[model samples]
Target: MTVRMTSARKAILEELESSKAHLTINQIHERLSGRLPSLNVSTVYRSLDFLSQNGLISISDMGVGTPVYEIMKEETHHHLVCSSCKQVIELENDLVAPFFEQIEKEKKTKVITNHLVVFGICLECKEY
Candidate 1:
């Protein structure tokens, strides 16, 4: 599905691509407001939805109250979120591949999503 790349979409994609942290719609809008004075939250929302649907970006809850968006990369990765501290730890695909494979085999279905967020208490929180 090919969609026209509007200025809003391009700016949104660039913002996500440049950011290491997953951004919410408000964050993205706030960050881009300096450069894109005319950009609105609704446009950001729409662009994010379009980007997510087109596989350019990924939206994950990451144990946060609201969803966060990040640009998709060639090397897929997951997240282990600390439920207490809300610290996000990047989980490598190596650890997840076999688990996904097992699910695929057991369910006889394909696992299409490249990223997953597992919420748990971190070591610090557990020790405390």
Candidate 2:
């Protein structure tokens, strides 16, 4: 499917894609408002929803108050989330093959998402 960007929506997307910082919708709108002062909150939200649904971006719950969005790529990785720091570490999905096979057999259902997130305190927090 071809993705066309309207001028304003494109501006919002460009802000999201260009940000090195993982930003919430508020952050996105904050950046865009300086450039496009007329940018509305709902437009930003709708654009994000559209981009996410079309596989143009990956929306991850980084354990922040709000979720963050990143440009979509083929890298299928999981997150090691730290409860103490809210840090999201991306790791390769090199494991879990056996569990997938077993689940599929027992449930007889097609596996949709193999993306698993392991959440706990990191070593630094344990030391404290």
What clash pairs does model 2 have?
Answer: none
Off by over 4 Å in 1: 1-3
lDDT of 2: 0.74
Error of 1 at 122 (Å): 1.3
**Which consecutive 10 residues in model 1 have the weakest lDDT in total?**
56-65
Cα lDDT of model 1 overall? 0.90
Stretch of 10 with least lDDT, candidate 2: 109-118
Clashing pairs in 1: none
Positional deviation of 128 in candidate 2, in angstroms?
3.2
Q: Encode model 1's per-residue lDDT on 34-66: one tens digit a residue.
A: 999999899999989998888888899887788
**Best candidate (score: lDDT):** 1
- Per-residue error at 52 for model 1, in Å? 0.7
